[model samples]
Target: MKPQRIFITGGASGLGYSLALICAKGGWRVCIADRDIERGEAVLGSLQKIQPQTIFMPCDVTQFDDLNAAATKLQEIWGGVDVVVNNAGVAQVGSISDTPLSDWQWIMDINLMGVVRGCKVFTPLFQQQGHGHFINVASMAGLLDVPNMSAYNASKAAVVSLSETLQNELKPHNIAVTVVCPSFFRTNLGQGMRSTITGMQSKLDKLMAGSKLNAADIARQIMRALDKKKSHVLPHRQGRIAWYAKRWLPRTWYQRLIHSQKK
Candidate 1:
């Protein structure tokens, strides 16, 4: 049997890197796509050692033509892709009023529309092949509607919504969609974060460093969910508990619970 072919955006570092490494080790033909050419090639070196056919693609998800061309190129090379991980995203923290309109558009373009473009470009390819899987990386902020990160939350929330829509819309077509909503873990996400808070970046770094589940742990959980064809995945226990609480708890009570974190 031929190895499964997988394409991952933002695959140079963080969860994307972990996912690519895992898939490559499992004998998949991996395409590591990111805008950072230096980092992408660095990761390419490692992946090539594991799976020589692994290729690095310089992809900026915000560009529709880039994504479309990537889909086209991969189709020609591999014949068909088994999975597309729309894992490229960024973090931003600020009150809605404090955040500039430009910042909102920036995050949404990369985080939300990036995933949309991936799906749009690949859905037809998947349909033609009769099988494909999409792994969309979201965040717990999207599910819980956390405070102080309006744009980031909204973008991820939109991804969750779109993933759900695709889950049902593509069910009969033999394509599977899984949205991963994970709380913070150790990652370089803070490095590119946009924030108005004076020390929020350092705080984010600290918060992520404190988490027990790192990117590799989350990546493994995602792979497991994909193998099982789960529609929704919350990789952390606390995230799952909070999601259930928000769903079952009363509105005022949940609001209090949400507020209690900072209080």
Candidate 2:
């Protein structure tokens, strides 16, 4: 039997790279798609040592043409992809009022529309194959409101919403959609993260450094969730707490808790 094939956007580094490692270890044919050709090729070389079936494709998820070409390439090489991980995203740290319009568009284009384009391109292929999974990497900010991350929050929230809708719509077709909502973990996203808030970059760096979970651990959790066919994967303990609190706690209480965190 052929190994299951998995394609990941932003697979050169961070969580996407970790996911690629995990899937390759499981004997899957992993295809990494990223805008950074150099890093993507480097990652492909590393993965080849573990699983020779791995390949790298230069992809910019923000561009539909890029994603379409990737899909076509996958079809030619592997017949079709068994899974597509829409994991390319950028982080923004600023209040909505402080965020520039260009920044908003940039974040949304890569974070939200990136996921949309992946799904739009792959859904048809999945339908033709009669089975597939979409792992969309959202964030805890999508589940709960956080200060100084309005743009990131909005983009992730849109992803969560889109994932939920796709989960329901694709159920009968045997395609699964899982939205991962993880809190801060060690990743390179911080390197390029845009922040208008004073000292926010350093603060974010500290938070990520302090976090116990790493990208590999999160990738394992995502694989577990995918095996169970879960719709949502919250890898962080704090993220789970916040998710439940937002759903079960009163609005006033949740507001108070959020306000207290700002202090």
Candidate 3:
């Protein structure tokens, strides 16, 4: 099939922007939905100069009305999107003891509920079209928990479960679902992440400093997996290994690994 239309949440920056650029290069109609209108427009302008077929729509994934409006706007232009990448998310750092209930709620509202809202709004439209794909961006944290990121881990774990469930529910409708579990890739998420307390943990900095893959590289792998209609898109080798180890290891070993830095 020819490149039709792809709508991506959080497409104004980071990995989403990179993915938008990739899809545009492949002759797809790209809609970059984001909460930041200025940033979204800037990305749209840049991509237009390079691709000329990309557009921008302001959308706050946490708000059902915003996503509904964005979805309606998209329908006017493209009728229905062929692919929806629910990638907008935030990481909040805190342990269960130190993490405030408000922080947990906020993190869940954005990271987990954001994907839920997107899927809720778009799946019906996709069904009407009789063909669609949904890509939910989870994290390596979803596969294995790390200290000082209880909220983030929980949100992503929820996304992992939700995505998998949707895959089973939407299979007969021809709407494919992919859950992307990626290890640390070079993205702006580190700088943008919010923490409940200062001096909580420098895990993000440590991870970024040691990260091997770039966002564009991960985006490429994701695109390839989408083309192959794969369900689980692990964009990094380490991610795959981590998943396997978590699955096969004893609870004691997993707990040790989760507490300690060594695998």
Candidate 4:
């Protein structure tokens, strides 16, 4: 599709940055969007070393106006996008009782509303073009809940639901939507999560340190999904197994596991 003009949110760092790098190497015209202008430009600089056509635009997925402006600007620059990757997100780790209302709202706005806004703002343009692909980044937590991560779990579950709904809704319009469920990746995700409670910080710190996969590995799987036009992408083997088990087993068993370490 004319080398696929691609726009990616959260493209300044982590999996987003890695995806940007790989796509540029593959000769796709890429525009990366993130809230941090400096980091976004820095990633753009690095990407240009690989593919001189890449560029960066400052954007906050949580802000609807910012998302609209980003879409408008990128559309004007590229003429129209063949792909949109809604990868921007924030994670919050806390039990439902411990998580404040404000924390839940914030996580929902970034993780769930961000994808909604992305589709709302960009889908029309894709419709005008008659074909486009969307890749929404959800977490493995979307498929299964974990202890001390009620807010994150809720947000990602919403993302998965929204993605599935849009996949069916947008099918008639010739738009393909894929939901990405990634397991523990050594991205700045743990470090970058927003937490209202201070006590959970140290625990999250330990979790990040123990992550097995890195951003590059996750990026590769995301690209595979994009190229293959797969509806659901699982970045890690454990993530796949986890989803399978959750699907086959009863909710009580999963709930028991979440409530305690015993399986």
User: Which of the numbered candidates is closest to the native, going by highest lDDT?
Assistant: 2
> Would you give me the overall lDDT of model 1?
0.92
Query: 16-40, model 2: which lDDT tens digit per residue?
Result: 9999998888899999999999899
TM for every model, in the order presented, reads 0.98, 0.97, 0.94, 0.92
The lDDT values for all models are 0.92, 0.92, 0.86, 0.85
lDDT of 3 by residue, 69-111 (tens): 8789889887878999999988788667877898888889989
lDDT of 2 at 62: 84
223 Cα displacement, candidate 1 (Å): 1.2
Name the lDDT of candidate 3.
0.86
Tens digit of lDDT per residue, candidate 4, span 22-114? 889889999999998988876787899988989888899988999899788877888889889999988887667877899888888899999
lDDT of 2 at 131: 98
Rank by lDDT, highest first: 2, 1, 3, 4
lDDT of 1 by residue, 30-140 (tens): 998999999999889999999999999899999999989999999999998999999999999999889999999999999999999999999999999999999999899
